[model samples]
Target: MLWAHGSRVSRLPKDRCSGITPPDKMPTRAPWQALSVVLILLWGHPRATLACPHPCACYVPSEVHCTFRSLASVPAGISKHVERINLGFNSIQALSETSFAGLTKLELLMIHGNDIPSIPDGALRDLTSLQVFKFSYNKLRVITGQTLQGLWNLMRLHVDHNKIEFIHPQAFSGLTSLRLVHLEGNMLQQLHPATFSTFSFLDYFRLSTVRHLYLAENRMRTLPAGMLQNMPLLENLYLHGNPWSCDCEMRWFLEWDAKSKGKNSQCDSWMPSPYRSGNIPFSSMPVLLCLGSA
Candidate 1:
């Protein structure tokens, strides 16, 4: 016999059941009724077992998925155990300091296709365990230094398809474990030397773990010498679709491209050595006219 939720439920011993009980000795319907009550009391209360948030589905373990909600802000009352949060295709404009404060177990955060114009400081300070963060297709213009602080364990970041024009030098300072960074399809005009370098004990060092760097479809003309130095693990570098200035200043980049041995590093506007001396290659360059003028 076992007592469940103040209800005494009787159980027959295995030795007493030899295979089948005689019709006269069989249990009555009253005992079966008691067993039904015990079963209902044990599994009837679903709210007590898992408190899933409204407009969101929380599956076993920890995963919250909410999309196309048109939510103007981060949904409140999210369970702390949620590991992944998909809030894409919403109307969120900005992120406050306390938007995602207590979610220490968060790993993947996708907030793409929103109207976020800017990211305030400490907006993601509490997401320490975050690994992949996607903020693509937003209206962001600039990335400040403190916008992504405290994300030490972050690995992949996707901020492409935005109108980003400027990135603070220290925007990616604390992201030591970052591996892939996607900044394509933006309006970036230049990159500072310290934009990707960090000060170490005695000298500056770039993120060595960064393997893939996507900077295509931007407005950049040239990169300063040693701007991408010390990235020993860098493999895939996408620098195409930009108006590359094939001048003396791009000697380092051209040399590096030639030495890449077809390792998926792309660049354009490279003239042969014979034509480098005041010779212009008009046939090799592609022209793009304005929208109204021919």
Candidate 2:
């Protein structure tokens, strides 16, 4: 009788089969819940690459049009493959660093008519392949160093038709691969010498190729000295339409004009009259010697 009772006890239910619960023990089936929490955290990063559907413009599949939207801040839901962005005709007043964090493959950013009062430093640090940047026709009073830090593959930059009064020193310090710069129709009071300094890769660029610079039709009295220093064989210079300040301070421009053989700049009918020599337009000379500052 004892042996039969012992065998019955051994055949009884195991812990899993038993529905009975021990009050002292906690539940153990919560591993899957913990794994779900980890997944949620991983996909929530702002810089993570995503795929968003394209709108009307066919040229840029990953591109988003925030135009005429009066968007005061950066747009969200950008895909990873976005190469060109057109935020023109918007009212974007400000931008942050990670505003473009989701677009790792971005190449061009166009912000033509926005009243962007300021662009924070390192605004484009990660965008190395950016080719053309346009900020034409806006209310830009000043450009800060924080605005331009890491745009290594930048080829063309246009900042024309605006209220740009000054360009901060070291503002264009890290822009080494820049080929063309357009600064026309602005409210510039003073020009800086470091405005057009090139730092790397000078040989592959053709002498006929454009390190082309356009400083035309604005409030420039005279260009800062040695502004074009160390620049080798620059092509297509257009500095006409400015009120040339013909003075002793404007003599260096004359010297550079003589050495350039008329390709580095175009100054015609600038000085009043060289024969009389009071304050002729600097354009008249092979290097025009204007009498007073513009």
Candidate 3:
């Protein structure tokens, strides 16, 4: 008889004389041998419980943490059932379309703090169920129209702290559900009028659902007229930390700001010092003392 310890089987009994079978009468194999073979085969089969990839830890059933792993690319064998994946603080340089091909149930993807320079078209199209995507602190230089396609359900996006210099007019085409966007700390100098506008039948009244927009810490000197017209639902707009020039080109914004502040007095508190200067013409302010000129 064999003794059992937890899930392991102990050694066989030392008594060899008891219940011994004659050599001529013994069967070719023990009766339990076939049963053991079946058990081994079943245990070796791939299943959900054994799907976690190497070096990454799955502390919960639906979340996978691969942060700080020094990974060069997305790891293979990620379970399709996983809902959240944290790939932050890795050395990943690029993402292929197949990186997350079958992960349709994925909702949150954190790939911040990497060296990715650009996202290929359709690379993230498979993430239809994704709600939150964090790609900040990367090396992206531009956002193309197809870079963010098929993310119909995405709500919040963090693309701040990159080197983005331009964004295609249709880059945000299908992101109708977006609520917040971060574009701060980049190299942007200008923006197209339709950069944030979605296609609408009323040509002059295109709109976006975004409530909070972060455009601080960039190189923009003046905003084009009607840029903010597309963001009717905007609640908070961060424009600090840019080299804003108080010139005739910004007259429309000053008028809009005054009108908006007249209706919503509380919004004045969110304005930078130069914008909050009451009853003073923006051009009268010394060019050297303009807000964000530092």
Query: What local lDDT does model 1 show for residue 233?
Result: 73
State every prediction's TM-score relative to the real structure: 0.72, 0.68, 0.74
Model 2 lDDT tens row, 1-294:
111474474444465446655656868658888888877876785334444433324344656666676777767667766788888987788888787775557788888998887666767777777888888887877887657677767888888887888887556666777788787888776776655554524433212122778777777777788666656747657777776665566678777777775743543224445444443444564333332323
The C-alpha RMSD of each candidate to the native structure, in angstroms, is 11.3, 8.9, 10.5
Put down candidate 1 lDDT per residue, 17-121, tens digits, no spaces: 567667788789998999999888867654445456668766654677778987888888876667888989989998888888888889999999999988888
Candidate 3: C-alpha lDDT: 0.80
Candidate that beats the other on lDDT, 1 or 2, i.e. the better one: 1
Error of 3 at 113 (Å): 0.5
Error of 1 at 2 (Å): 29
Model 3 misplacement above 4 A: 1-50, 202-205, 261-294
Q: What pairs collide in candidate 3? A: none
Per-residue lDDT for 1-294 in model 3, tens only? 565799999776768547776578889677689889988887776443447787899898788899999999999989878899999999999988788887888899999999999998888888899999999999999999999887888889999999999999888877888889999999999998878865455565577888888998888888889888888888888877776655456767767676563233111122355455433444344342443454
171 Cα displacement, candidate 3 (Å): 0.6
Worst 10 residues of 1 by lDDT: 283-292
Which pairs clash inside model 1? none
Model 1: number of backbone collisions = 0
